[model samples]
Target: MLETGATGPSAIVLNGGSSSGKSSLALALQSELPGSWLRLGIDDFIDALPPRLVGAGGFEVEADGAVTIGPAFTALEQQWQAGVGAMARHGAHLIIEDNFVSGVAAQKRWRKALEGVTTAWIGVRCTPVVAAEREARRGDRIAGMAARQALIVHEGIEYDFTVDTTNADPTTLARSIAHRLAR
Candidate 1:
C-alpha cells in the first residue's frame, strides 16, 4: 500500500537545463537523503518514446541544440507529468528532473499537479560556458544545448532554493538540498 502524507517532503523537483548536472545531483541526493526516493525525468520519458516519435513525430532536435516539442509530444508529456504526480500522491518521494523550457507555464503545470503533495522545488544552475564544457566532456548530449538552455530553463520558477554546479560538485550540492529537506 502507498503511504500518503508521511513526515517530511515527499517530492523534490530538480529544475535545470541539459548538462547542468541534474542527473548527477539526483544521484548524489539519493545517497544523501534518508529512505528511498524515485527519479523521474524528461530523459526517462524521452527514452521510452517510440523511435517513430523520437526526432520527428513529437519532438525535434536541431543541430544547433535547439529542441521543439510538437503537439503529440506535448500530449505525451502531460501524461508523464500526471503519472509522476500520481506517484507522489501514492506517497512515493519523487525527485523530478526537468527543464522548464516553457518557463512559468511549465512550472505552474507542475505546481497544480502537485498541489496537495509536499513538493520542494530546486533550481539547478550552471553557467552556460561551464555547462557546455561539461556537455562536451560527457559526450552524450547534443552540442550547444547546455548554452541554449542554461538560462531559459529557470526563467520564471521560484525555487525553494537554488544550487550552482558551476563550481560546486554534485555531492556538495546534494548536501545543501538534503539540509533543506532536513529542516
Candidate 2:
C-alpha cells in the first residue's frame, strides 16, 4: 500500500516464517541493486543482543517468560525507519528482511510503527516440510518446528506479495521484488 509520492525506490520488506528464504532473498536484492539499495536484517539486531537478555531459544523471549518480540521488533522498526530515512536522503532504495510474525498484537504494533514509512511487505511462501528442512540446515535457534509453523500462519496474513520460494532461486526472487519496486 505504498503510494507513488513515497519519495524512495519502493522499499521492500521480506516478512515470512523461519527458513522461508527471507534473508536469502533480501541479500540477493541488496547485491542486485548494489549502491541503489540497502538491506537490513532483523537477525542482525537479534543476534547481537546480549546473550542473557535473550532467553531459551532466543526468539525474542521477554523477561516475563513470554515469547514476546516487542523490544526486538521495536528495534527493528526503528532501524527500518532510519534506513528508509537514510535511503531517501541518499536517493537509494531499501530492503528489510525479518520474521515479524509474533502474533496479531505484534503485527498491530508493527503496523503502528510503520505508519509513516513507504514500505511493502513481501512474504516468502513455502511448505511446512520445506520450512523445517531449511531451518534445520540453517541451524539457528528457531525455537522448533511448531514455532516456525505458527510464525508462517501469522506472516501469511501480513504480506503484500507471497512468493513461493521452494523451487525458485534466491536471485530470481530478488528480481521479482526489484521488478515490483521498479514498477
Candidate 3:
C-alpha cells in the first residue's frame, strides 16, 4: 500500500485534456477505494470563482489556434492549486483531476507544492475524435477546447499509470488503479 507521509495524506493526480474522462475516473475511484478519498478537480475550483469571473475572458484563442489563459484566471488557478497542496499537507487523501497545459508555469508550481508527498501521477488519455464527441454531448465545455487541449496537456509528463478512456470503462479503470494502490 502507498504510505501516507508523516505530515499528510497521499494523492492521486489525474492529468488529462478536456473531456478526457478524468472526472468520471475520479468518481469511480472514490466509490471503489476503501477509505475516504476527496475528489477535487479544476471544476471544483472554477465553481468557487465568482460567476462574473468565470467566463469573462478567462480563455482566449489566438490566430494560430492556440489557447491562452487570462492573467486573472491564471492567478486564481494558482491559488486553487496551492490550496490542493495545503490540503494534502494537512492529511487529505485527494484525487485531483486536472486538464493541465504541458510546459506551463503552473505545472512546475504543482510539482513544487506536492514535493515530498506520496503522489501517483496518472495520465488520462483519449483520442481527439472521442474527446470531441464527448465534449459535444456534454455541451458544458467551450467549443474547440478538446482539440486545443489535446495538443498540449501530455507533452512532457511521465505517468505512473495511464488509462485510455476512449476504450476502457471508468469503473474497470478505477478498479485497476485501486488494486495498484493497495499494493
Candidate 4:
C-alpha cells in the first residue's frame, strides 16, 4: 500500500454550530498543533462570497436565526470545499469548521473532496441553551441561531472524538484534543 504523508493529519475538520467556539478552537489548535495550519471555515467562506449570494438568491440569515441557502450558495460551497481539500492534497495543513446541517450527507461530501488526504473529524459540542446565550451576547449573530443549529449539526454525523464547549474554554479544549489525538 502507498504510504500517506508523514506529517500527521493533513486536515482537521471541526464541525459545530454558531457560537459554539469552533473559531476559537481553531485558533487555539493552531497554537497547540505542530503546524502552520490554514483555517478555512463556513463563515470565512460565506464572508468571501459575493454580496448577492449572501442574502438574495443565495444564503439568508433569517430573523428567527434560521439559515437558508439557495442553489447558488450550495454550488459555491461545494467548490469551496473542494478547493480547500485540494489545498490539503497539495500539502497544506487545514483547519475546517463547517456546520453540517445536512448531517451525514454533508460529511460524505467532505469525504469525497478529501479523498486520499489524511483528515481528522472533531465534533464541537455545546448545549443549545449555552449556545443561545453566547449568540445573544455576541450581538453580531442572529437570534436563536445557536439553538437552531446546536443539535441539528451533530445529527447523523460521527466524529473521531467530541469536545464540549459548554464550559471548557477554547485553549483548554484544544489542548485536550491535541493531547488525545497525539496519543
Tell me each candidate's TM-score.
0.93, 0.72, 0.85, 0.93
Highest-TM-score candidate = 4
Better of 2 and 4 by lDDT: 4
CA lDDT, candidate 4, residue 181: 65
Candidate ordering by TM-score (highest first): 4, 1, 3, 2
Number of colliding residue pairs in each model? 0, 0, 0, 0
* Residues forming the 10-long window of minimal summed lDDT in candidate 3: 1-10
Cα lDDT tens digits for candidate 1, 9-107 = 888889999999999999999999989999888899899887778787587778999988777887788888888898899979889999987788788
Q: Write candidate 2's Cα lDDT for 16-121 as tens digits.
A: 6667787788778877763666676666766666675465443454332234544654565566556555554455566766665554554564455455556676
* Top-down lDDT ranking: 4, 1, 3, 2
Candidate 4 Cα outliers beyond 4 Å, as residue runs: 1-6
Candidate 4 Cα deviation (angstroms), residue 146: 0.6
Evaluated at residue 50, the lDDT of candidate 3 is 72
Give the lDDT of residue 137 in candidate 3. Answer: 94
- For lDDT, candidate 1 versus 4, the one ahead is 4
| Each candidate: RMSD | 3.3, 4.4, 3.2, 2.4
lDDT of 4 by residue, 52-82 (tens): 8889679898999888888898888889889
The lDDT values for all models are 0.86, 0.62, 0.78, 0.87
Candidate 4, position 65, lDDT = 83
lDDT of 3 at 2: 33
